[model samples]
Target: METNGTELRISGVLGRLEAVLERENSLIGTDARFDITASNAQKSRCLYELNLLMKSMEPSDLPRAAGDRLIRLRSVVETNATRVKAHMEAVRDVTDLINEAVQAAEADGTYSMDTFRPAAQ
Candidate 1:
C-alpha cells in the first residue's frame, strides 16, 4: 500500500498523542508533583489536527496499520483516563479531610451539652 501524505500526518499525530498520554499515565500516581496542563494541551492539539485530517477522508479509506494504531492508542487513552480518575478522587478525599479539619477547629462549642448543663452543687 502506498502511504500518502495524509496517512503520514495521521500516523505522526497518533504517535504524538500516544506519547503524551503515556507520559501522563506515568506521572499520574507518582509521589513527585507533576502538572498535566502541558500534556493536556498537547493532546488537545493533536486530537484537533487528527480530527481535521480524518474529516477529509472516509473510514474505509483509512490504512490498516493506521486503524491498528488507533486501537492501541485507544487502550492507552483508556488507561490514562482511569489513572486520572483515581488521582482526582484522591485529591478530593484530601480536600474533604482538610475541610473537615478546618470546620472542626473553627467550632466554638457554644451549643454543647456542657453549656446547657446545671451548675455543679
Candidate 2:
C-alpha cells in the first residue's frame, strides 16, 4: 500500500489529538493547578487539521489501521468531553448554591426583633 501525504498528515493529526484527549482526561479532578487552555488550543488545532485532511481524502480510501485509529481517537475525545461537561455541571451547582446562600444571608440581615415586629395593630 502506497502512503500518501494526506494519509500521513491525517495519522499525525490523530496521534496528536489522541495525546491531547488523554492529557485532558488525566487532568480532570486530578489537581488544582491543571489548566486546560493550552490543551484546548492544541485540540482545536488538531481538529482543524483533521477536518482539512478528511475533506481531502475519500473515506473508503483510508487505510484500515488509520480508520481504526480514527475511531479510537474519536471515542476518547467524546469520553473526555463528557467528563468535562460533568465537571462543569458540578462547579455550576456549587456556585449556584453559594450564590443562594449569599442572597439569603443578605436578605436575612442581622435579624433584629424590631425589624420583624408588625406595625402597631
Candidate 3:
C-alpha cells in the first residue's frame, strides 16, 4: 500500500507523543521532578503538527490499517490524559493539606491568650 507524506508525518508525531507520555508516566510513578515546561512544549508542537496533517488529510484517504492504528493511539492518549489529571489532583490535595497543617500550627502557637498573663481588673 502507498503512504502519503501527511500520513507519515502524523504517524511520526503520534509516536513522539506516545514516547513523551510514557516518560511522564514513569516520572509520576517515581515521584521524580521533571521539566514539565519543556515536555509540554514538545507535546504542543507534536499536536500542532498532527492538527495540520489531519487538516490536509481526507477521511477517505486514510487506509483501513492506519485508521485502526489511530484509534489505538487515541485510546492511549486518553488514558495518559486521565492519569495526568489524577496526578495533578493528588498534588493539589497534598498542597492543601500542608497549608491546613501550617495554619493549625500557627493558631496553636505558644503566644496564644492561654499562655499570656492578664492584669487585675
Candidate 4:
C-alpha cells in the first residue's frame, strides 16, 4: 500500500537496529550498531522501519531545523518535526477563522469589509 511520494527518512539508530535483527546485516561499530546482510533485505527492512517510525511520530509545536549547515544535520529532525506541527496548527487556525467569518457573512446577508473585519484591536 504505497501512499504519496516518498519523503520519509527514519533515524540512523533505528536503521542499525533493524540491521541487527538479522545476524548478517549489522555493522561493526563494535556495538550492536553493525550487522552484515544482503543489500536487498537491508534496504527493505530500512524502508519498513522508516515507515513504522514516521507513522508513529507526531510533529512538534514549533517548526524549525536545528542544524542547517552543521557537519551532520543531526538536530534538523526535531526541528522538522516541530515545524510540521506548527504548520498544521497554523493552517487549522486560518481555516477556522475563515469559516467563522463566512458564517457571519451568510447570517448577515452582507459581505461588507466594515462589518467583517473580525473585530481588530
For model 2, the local distance difference test gives 0.83
Worst 10 residues of 3 by lDDT: 1-10
Candidate 3 lDDT: 0.75
Root-mean-square deviation (CA) per prediction: 5.9, 5.1, 4.5, 19.6
Q: How do the candidates rank by TM-score, highest first?
A: 1, 2, 3, 4
How much is 11 displaced in model 1, in angstroms? 0.6
Error of 4 at 4 (Å): 30
Which candidate leads the pack in lDDT?
1
What TM-score should be assigned to candidate 3? 0.74
lDDT of 1 by residue, 1-121 (tens): 2358878998999999999999999887794567877778998999999999888788999988889999988889999999988988998999999998777755767556687899999
Q: Between prediction 1 and prediction 2, which has the larger lDDT?
A: 1
* Candidate 2 structure quality by residue, lDDT tens digits, 1-121: 3467766887888899999889889887686687877878999999998887777567787877789997777789789989889878988999999999888876777555667889997
Give the Å error, residue 46, model 3: 1.1
Give stretches of model 4 more than 4 Å off: 1-74, 111-121
Q: Write the per-residue lDDT of candidate 4 for residues 35-112, one digit (tens) a residue.
A: 323533665676576566557445431112211212143343344345445655876999999999899977885866
Give the higher-TM-score candidate: 2 or 3: 2
lDDT of 3 by residue, 1-121 (tens): 2376666766788788778877776675465668666877888887888787777567897766668777887777787788788878988999999999888877987546656667657
Candidate lDDT (C-alpha), each: 0.87, 0.83, 0.75, 0.46
* Candidate 2: pairs in clash: none
**Between candidates 1 and 3, the TM-score winner:** 1
How many clashes show up in model 4?
12
lDDT over C-alpha atoms for residue 61 of model 3: 77
